[model samples]
Target: MSEWRGVAQGCAVIVGVLLAGLAGAGIWIAVYMQGDPQPDVAKAARSHTARAADLLVTAHVDQQLAQLRTALPWATHLGTTVADICETYPANTGFTRRTWTPVMCTRTGTAYLAFDGDFREHLAQLDTALAAEGWKPTNNAGDQPGLVADLDYTHRPPGDATAAELAEAAARPNVATVRYTLPIPSTFAVPPGAGGGPFPIGTVEVAQAPHLPTIDDGTAAHDLTLETRHFVDWQPYSHTQLSTAYPAHGAILAISVRLPYNT
Candidate 1:
């Protein structure tokens, strides 16, 4: 009977210890909670840096293209006037944190008649202008210097190119195409604001879109096409290939600038 009583007292002590431990834990949690209120993320502004980066890069594209227009008044814009997009990425591999970066693309083609005299001088001048704008010319494709403009018959069928047209394209290979890159110094690490999860892959929520002078008629649509070919295609800009269907047999230049993001 005494042994039974001792066992009961021991069990009671064990239960009391557990209850005390639980109570301490609860008190600690309450104190921790009291220290800082949960952030009212609802009131926070959507990332200014993300949007600023978007606008900055897009403006860079517009400015560069306008410069090109000034240098070569007769130069024709091929494809979309420009592909200015800010692509979102997960800062971590777990896809919890989000960040965004901007990429701008543009292409221009000139007439074959003007290719000989005007193209060379104008292209050099444009290069100088771009260099002044903090864009460095790179011959390395891996540098992701943006897109290179060229006569692209790859999308067309094998027999799509006639022997004469191919010869003509080959004969006039004086088109000057250059790619440029603008290195971004800041990391665009955007916090998850009032919203949860990152922005949709193909969509850009830029506040400055309405006030912009020129409409981006080509980039989003081409991005959609690219999404089909390669799922969630972050890079819509590539070799700005002028198809045989489109007669762009002049000076060709493609520019791409990829923004920085947190890893």
Candidate 2:
């Protein structure tokens, strides 16, 4: 009888250990599920970004594009729309915070003519038109690499131009960049209590920086496969550009204008 009583006590001890293990696992899972709380500034920045995106899509994008189209009547407006670019901030507190702010937008317009030919003249006209709209060319300080703030198409070698220059001049669908700094009021305005003053957001290279939207179309642009179809919102040019293939004479006009605040 005493041996049977000892065996029963051993079984009870095993059951007690199993029950404690299960309870500990449950507690651990609960703690893990309740991730670290976000900072108030992070929350404010996200909200501000959303509001800025909405304003760009609803009011600013069309208005600005209209002005541009009028300025460049020969160029076909491909697509232009604001996207919610996700930005991640790593914290030393064992968790990473992700937020979207400093909203970005990209525009692609094309001319049926060659970039090194008649399009060069048109671009100079565009510079003048943009200046009227408060966009000015940056000096050497803010000039971006591989992109020129002021394009000098008339430049020729001191003597006779080389064969490379001759071929480059006649190359179809070539690219020329013209950088401009526009003081965009949209980026400056923030929600109350955001705790940031009026300062320049710095140069925003939309193509290089910012994670593109998750949406994919499985289309190929040149050798690379472009999953995100440039436009994130349903703007006037979205549907037409998505359906249309880049024309044979299409001179790709990539514009990366940063709308930072005046410091």
Candidate 3:
């Protein structure tokens, strides 16, 4: 009986030790979580940067296009010509000189002008203009000369707040602040051997947002954004036939100033 009693006491001690250890672990976890909370800076900055990039690109394109148009008025309307021919046989056409005669030739055309100018100089001017507007240029190594820029911006709430309050404020859509830097471009020149010509250009591209939120913000906002990057890419020197469907040049303009409220 004494042995059985000792065994029972040992089991009770083991159970007590386990319960105490579990309680201590729980307390440590709670303290750690409270001390090191997840940050909202990355999330807020991403949201703000995306919207700001869209707005800035739109404004930049509009201003640049206006400037280009004013400088080169002839670029507005270009013209192209097409020819049609009709053939007829003469009455005395027996293996003779007048066997076949040209009856009529018709020509049709349109006033759609192709882009022309000193493209390299124009690109330089655009780069200068973008620099004056607070955009920093990025260096890219390739055959074609290109212009890329980055802009950084930040925002904060109007009033003072504690860390906890600031964190909570960040959670609030209206109170939270954001900061980010995004790379953009003003113009791009298609590389040689692209088949379009020696100076094909890609101005702008508009498409849906490249990134979507993983978590729902309850706003159901679905909108598009512009991808100024890859406005032009290099084509290798080869004798391969060029695709006929590709555009020789492009000058698309898209602008959006509204901030992403629920992104």
Cα TM-score per model: 0.35, 0.44, 0.27
- Which candidate's lDDT is highest? 2
Looking at candidate 1, what is the lDDT of residue 147? 20
TM-score order of candidates, top first: 2, 1, 3
Clash count (model 3, backbone only): 6
Q: Give the clashing residue pairs of candidate 1, or none.
A: none
Q: lDDT tens string, model 1, 1-263?
A: 99999999999999999999999998987675444332222121134543455454445444544554455454444433333322332223432223322222222211111221354354445555555666665444332331222112212223677887677665554433343445433323333341323321111100111111121324445535332121112323223333321232433443333332211
Candidate 3 deviant stretches above 4 angstroms: 34-121, 131-136, 142-250, 253-263
Q: How many residue pairs clash in all the candidates, one count each? A: 0, 0, 6
The lDDT, on a scale of 0 to 1, for candidate 2 is: 0.39
Please say which candidate is ahead in TM-score: 1 or 3: 1
- TM-score of predicted structure 2: 0.44
lDDT of 3 at 169: 45
lDDT of 2 by residue, 58-118 (tens): 3543455466557766655455543322222323343323322332332222211112235
lDDT of 3 by residue, 30-81 (tens): 6654443323322432455434543443354345344433544424322221
Off by over 4 Å in 1: 1-49, 79-129, 132-134, 140-178, 183-251, 257-263
